[model samples]
Target: MAVSLTGTRISVVALPWFVLVTTGSATRTGLVAFCEMAPYVVVKAFTGPLVDRIGPRAVSWTTDLASATAAAAVPLLHVLDLLTFPLLLVLVAVIGAARGPGDLAKEVMVPEAAEHGRVPLERATGLSGVVERLASTVGLAAGGALVTLLGPLTGLAVNAGCFALGSVLVGLALPRGTGRAAEDPAAAPAERSGYWRRFGEGLAFLRGDPLLLTVIVMLGVTNFLDAAFASVLVPVWARESGHGPTAIGLAGSVMGAAAVGGSLIAAAVAHRLRRRLVVLAGFLLVGAPRFLILAADAPLGAVLAVFAVGGFGAGFVNPVLGAVLVERVPRRMLGRVNALGDSLSWAGIPLGGLVAGAAVAAAGLVPILLACGTAYFLATNLAGLRPEWREMDRTRGRDAVKRRAPA
Candidate 1:
């Protein structure tokens, strides 16, 4: 997860900048983002059953290898003078397609890893958050420097190398049978069933849970806003404000570093706190403010401060969210349910960059940033008021139960 996600974070920084610099069009930059994430959302949504039946271990490494090939081809072709916009889109789409299943495979293994260690779900997921934040911090900082120094192609080359390394680690480094298919009675029968039937079962499970459904809808909206922020708003802000890519990297790394601290704290004690309050407070801190700050043309220090505070708040969110989902879903159906939920939360990602780019072109960057901030505030607040969210605190896995030490 660390190796692969770090590579992705670098791409997140490099890819948008590459298109923006090369094409000089926000809409085209967004189009490139759309091509990648659209396939990510669609393929991830449908590949859940395969992850379950085929085993996450096999699915992860194989798809990652595919992603490595596609990612490597971008720079390879670009260097050979054969790269074009259409071809770029095609390669990114391939990367996205492979990444979807590969990511899902890695995610579904978290709970089992926690079980083996007898660690609480919150702590386990919090540690996972720490890894993610650490990766982002390192990747973004490095990517920004590499892109600034050598060019975006250098960053792209690094991304390909990371993907290749990720495949090797998953395929040959992990212990045998680490993420093998579940051995549930349901698992055996379900393995024999048609793909659609398995997928339908997952959908049905997800649809029946009001809390999960509500979480999905809220996150879908927030993720869209986030996508807009990361892919377009920040890049445009950097270009217009004269901060450039280095500032973007610096702000992101500060935030991510702070988030690592937050996640560590959450891993240590978040399970003892009221999950609902933590989530609500985290939402308040994470959203709206950064957008508003950038819109106000805040100084670099001010921008970085807001981002750091928000990043710290952001750290508490995913552990609680991950714990909640895994606590409710049976181990047998975990992969599919997680896949569906994640894909739904990410569904609006492709459209986010697309819409933001067009909106920036039509109106301006500040207006879109303000609008995204306002939307984020409203979505988080309204979602908090939903009765279904109370359920977030209701479920707890056996592993999450703390045992008293003998005197």
Candidate 2:
């Protein structure tokens, strides 16, 4: 997870800076991002069934290793004087492809790990969230320092190393006989369908379960708003506010640090909360105040305060989502289901970046920030009105179903 968290943060921050510096066009930078992410979403959607079929442990390490190799190749080519814009695009796309499956594997492991230890899924998921936030916190700070001191390629180097390290950890650290393997005897039934058919079955599950569908849509919109804010507005706002690139980097680090704090707190107390209500409140906290605070054109201290609060709220979100997913998905289907849901949730990101770039260019930073934040707040809350969210139970429902199966 550390490798994943650090590697992703480094790539995300470093890539944009590299493109912006080299190409000198925000739109073009966004297009590079779009090229990497669009294919990422599409490919990951199909890979979910494969994960379920093959199991997550293999999926995680293999993909991480592949991603590391691709990432390492980028700098080697650059140093060899063979790198070009198109080549950079292809390298980043490869990283994206690997990252999608790697992410699904990690998420699928959370519940299983919890069950193996006789811990609640919420608690385990909270720890997962903390790991992510802590990784972001450390990675963002390191990314800033590396980019500022050693340049963007240095950050990319760190990213590649982290992916390689994460692959090693996943391959070696996790014990066998965790999570879902404890519950199901019939999970790996004789393969009755082709890989494509099984993948379609996963999609069918999403289509039939309105609760899961709503959660996916909600997460998708939230991801879109976050991408717009992070990729476009935050950097532009920092420059316009006279903070420059260093300040942009620092702001990200600060937000990530606050998120880490939030997630750690969540890990300590996540079991006490009611999932549905907390999620609604978290959305309100995370979404409503960001644009308003940014538009206020506050001082540096005030800006940091606003982001800290927003990040804290965001920290509260992921664990609940993770727990919900783990509890509900059959062990055999975890990879495919997780991949599908995650792909849908992340699908809006590239477009969000593109839209934010256009909006910032046309409408200026503050107004667009306000509008996007407001839209995110509204969309998330509106999603909560659906009956499925309230009806779902992360604990009792799936466990009861498992118990009822014949011995």
Task: Provide the TM-score for each candidate, comma-separated.
Answer: 0.96, 0.92
Model 2: residue 127 alpha-carbon error in angstroms = 0.3
Q: What lDDT, from 0 to 1, does candidate 2 have?
A: 0.76
| Per-residue lDDT over 1-407 for candidate 2, one digit per residue giving the tens place of the 0 to 100 score | 87777888877677777777777666666666776777778888888776665667888899999989988988888889898988988887898888887887777777666666677677788888878887777777787778778888888888999999999988888776431222335544544346776787778877887888898998888888888777767767765787655666676777777777777777777667877877887788778687788888888888778778877877878887777776666666667777788889899986777888777777788888888878888889899888888755445455546623442
Best by lDDT: 1
Candidate 1 clash pair list: none
Count of clashes, each model = 0, 2
Worst lDDT window (10 residues) for model 2?
A: 177-186
Q: In model 1, which regions exceed 4 Å deviation?
A: 186-191, 397-407
Best by TM-score: 1
